[model samples]
Target: MKVQLLVSKWCPVCPQAERIWTEAAQKVPMDLEVLDVAERNGREVVSRLRIKTVPAVVVDGTLKTVGVQPLGEVLKLLGA
Candidate 1:
């Protein structure tokens, strides 16, 4: 599975999301990608995904969840 953790440089919750997903990635077998919403590619992705918030998770090209999700929820989303 492929997981994209979308974050914004100024968002307070972004770090939390990153940390949570980073830890989860160690236990899961999926590929994880971290995107900064402030950048061009990240902006394009956010726009394409129709995401209005930071700390979003995209699973296999589909936006799955938004906000800072717990590690368990993230792992569950990845079917780990």
Candidate 2:
């Protein structure tokens, strides 16, 4: 599964989300992709993914997480 984390530069929520995804990544068979919204292809990814919030987590091309989340919380979302 492809797990993409879309976050903004200096976003308060990004760090927490990152930790959760990082932990979940270890437990799940997923390719993790972290994208900073301020970088190249950032806008396009958000647009194609229909992301309206930061710290967004997309799994298998579907938006599954938004905003900040705890590691345990994220795991439940990923069914890990």
Candidate 3:
């Protein structure tokens, strides 16, 4: 599976979501990519993903969830 976690530094939920993603990613046997919305071209990447909010999880090119989902749920969303 290919998982992308999209977030911005200013987003309150981003950090927590990042932690959750990191943990889940360690368990899932696939590629994990994190896109910081504050990075250059970050906005464009988010827009291409059709994501309207930070702390968004895009799994295998599909929007799974946004904001802070429970770690277990986040893992499930990633198909782990």
| Highest-scoring model, lDDT | 1
C-alpha lDDT score of every prediction, in listed order: 0.88, 0.83, 0.80
Misplaced by over 4 Å in model 1 are none
lDDT of 1 by residue, 1-80 (tens): 88888998899989989999999989988789999989887898899989999889888889999998788887777777
Best candidate according to TM-score? 1
Which prediction has more favorable lDDT, 2 or 3? 2
Model 2 Cα RMSD, Å? Answer: 1.3
Ranking by lDDT: 1, 2, 3
TM-score of 1: 0.93
Across residues 1-80, which tens digit of lDDT does each residue of candidate 3 receive? 88888888788878898888888878877687888877866676787876788888777778878889887887676566
Question: Model 2, 16-54: lDDT tens per residue?
Answer: 788878888998778999988888766778989878889
Instruction: Report residue 17 deviation for candidate 2 (angstroms).
Output: 1.0
Instruction: Give the Å error, residue 14, model 2.
Output: 0.6
TM-score per model over all chains: 0.93, 0.87, 0.85
**Superposed model 2: Cα runs more than 4 Å off:** none
Worst 10-residue lDDT window, candidate 2: 71-80
